[model samples]
Target: MTGRLYNSEQIRDIEQQAIAEMAQGDFVLMQQAASALLGLLKQRWPCRKRLLVYAGAGNNGGDGYLLAAYAQAEGYQVAVKCIGDHALLPKAAQMAKKATEQAEVPLLALSAAFKADVVVDALFGIGLNRPVSGDYASAIEQINQSSCPVLAVDVPSGLCADTGQVLGSAVKASVTLGFIGHKIGLFTADGPDHCGDLLLEPLSIPQRIFAAQEYSARQVNGAQLLAQLQPRCAHFHKGQAGHVVIVGGDFGMAGAPLLSAEAALRCGAGLVTVLTRKEHVPALIARRPECMVHGVEAQQDLHPFFLKASVIVAGPGLGQQFWGQQLLQQVLMQNKPVLLDADALNLLTQQTTPQLKQLILTPHPGEAARLLQCSSKEVQQNRFKAVQALHQQYQATVLLKGNGSLIAGEKDLQLLNAGNPGMASAGMGDLLSGIIAALWAQGLNAETATALGSWLHATAADHLAARFGQRGLLALDLLTEVRTLLNQPCSG
Candidate 1:
């Protein structure tokens, strides 16, 4: 009933179902979870023997206690930092603590300057909604400030499992092992930043339990999405690829639309046309001779070019001047696939609607905030909600760009799982708009184009960052890889 990511409620339901149908007790599940964590630790960090665990008051803490017991049994030096009172611990947690005590694992209460080869963060799990404070906050801070590598049992403590935001402060882990079904929180917003090398551990649950539940969203990595590209026939021609019209590049921002046009060309747009100011025409032609760069003085100049546009990509380098507004007005009137970005999104806020149906809106958080009449902070607090609201308001396929880019459409809600931090440069959105337009022109629908375009853009960025490093990466650095990726037979 679902995809790759599930909310906390859904994960709980799956756990309940597993416990009921699989005839597994809660204690058995905790034991299996702890065993899984220990196995992962041994496999990934065999040289490290000193283990420090933070045991909270929930079943999540119970997992930590059992892990300490299992590790102690295996002769690994282990210590537990008992955060909450043992009397307040859950039934399973009490049993786990008793077992750990039986195993002779030392339990202490110290909040700062802790040293361990590896830290196990089992303080909180998916149910925590309130912000961390007091002693819990101090422990998380110490964990973050420490030099030890952290293995978050299910999720990093202090992070909201549903919204993927920090409740107050979150433990930054070297690796996070998500149990049972993958949580939706682990793949969006700040989730990607806090979760290093995130992985899933099923804890030996039966597949039938998972197959019956529903998920919130899908984790769409570029590698998994690339299999959609089919081989072209020998008779296929440039004419069959479709025409993509780009409007923007007013005065000082000429580089924006040019980047978009180049991206479209590289992604196999049949015929590419750029409607920009006369000032950018020479540079546009000089940069990419194949693109038909027309110097438009008014909306009339855009009229001639719109006739051939299979798809229109607006807003790249589109300034908020009279020129950019005029171009946008003409674009909205056309009954074609339209993509809004950069200044075009900025301009969209000021204009009256023209029934832009076959449309796609690619907005970063700030632009999304402007469109939604909310703060960027609000939009980022729950990215899933913001993207859905954008789609509902604009009635367009919406892609919200950020740490883990999110796409909202009529069918699927996908989050990008392939991009790196290096893509946080100027002109990335412009390039993304172009790629989406090119794919739309080449025969995909607006929604598919937006989703695939997002994956392609991120995948290309990842390919470049893999070799050159992300510190000084440029937007244009992805063009070569984008072309190479489109031509090759990509395996999912």
Candidate 2:
């Protein structure tokens, strides 16, 4: 997850370097780009012949013009709707315009309606910084309103390449074709919703150009992270798998820790224990006899559990009552790998103690806002900045859950895009807490466990939703799927 996502500045620098250093001239690069788009477009919709392209005033427009020229040459009727004056176009785009003229592609007036099978959006690219207005806004809306499948060039116009924030009006593209480096906004925040069937074309940038540049963040790579847990050997026993302790489920909230414990066991933890209220112990133990349930009322009751636990997952249904606080304080002192989630995060905001060496903070947007002393809107405004601030402020790994879940540590930042809308249900975070804790108990480092666990949690949910619709997808449904994913072989 380290070098997969980049900011506008980084992508711009790489593009500039490519233009200056590579033997492939700027016009040749544009032609190669158009060729890549044509290949994908033909593969996706070979039967569709009518092509309508919205050309702007930049290199992005140049790409669209060239694509139109390529399609026209292939006998696909093509038309160009110029959103900007061709006189203002850059050198490469002007060259592309000349190419389009030579190809005899028709030019349509802006007032005309869309009649093509596919609409190509080349109006804006990574350089967009302000809210789209006037003709630009009109063009974006027209593209969105069209029933035809739209292909966005480079980026969906109006999206912030640096942060993924949408401008006044952004095209909801059926697909977005990116170039050079992956933009940060395309994977997080509003980017996931706007970008459909994402594809990246490196345009064959030389290896040295990329080798010299650094990235802003990375995609939460499943195969690399899954490698942390090798397929278990036949000789390995339950004792070698490690022990996980779930320390929440106060009074009426017994189900949270039970769900967590079940996930821990399902995800390969050798042993699972739930410490909860004395009244709820019988039912918790009855529902899942595999977990050893212990009821504790006093702080001293945590001693034996902490002594034997390889990792502690705290805060799932851990109410703000004295009973929960008493145990949390002692749990922190145990010096074992711990995950602070649910109500635990709410309580941690009041504490001044320095966090532990292996403590992980998993907070949804609202909870994250509480911990950061800011509004939830502010946290969502720029999630990377927020996660980084949380990691630096608490001096521990932080996982911010949302549309695109982010995992941040001292030197790592990973984003998970495998989840679905169905995950809006309850007990999801509790289940995630268990998965991470189980991995930690089984000997993965805190960062790996957090990143991989996030991936597993989301991917499992996605798998279930894909088979059975996203609605009403229970958190419990993921346990078996998680086991299946863990045992299956993964490809890079």
Residues 56-162 of candidate 1 have per-residue lDDT tens digits of: 88999999999999999998999999887778987878899999999998888864334589999999999999999887898898789778889998999999888
Predicted structure with the largest lDDT when compared to the true one: 2
The C-alpha stretches of model 2 lying farther than 4 A from their native spots are 1-3, 230-235, 489-492
Error at 221, model 2, angstroms = 2.5
Give residue 199's lDDT in candidate 2 (0 to 100): 89
lDDT scores of the candidates, listed in order: 0.87, 0.88
Per-prediction TM-score: 0.96, 0.94
Which pairs clash in model 1?
none
Query: Which segments of model 1 are wrong by more than 4 Å?
Result: 1-3, 111-115, 221-224, 490-492
lDDT of candidate 2?
Answer: 0.88
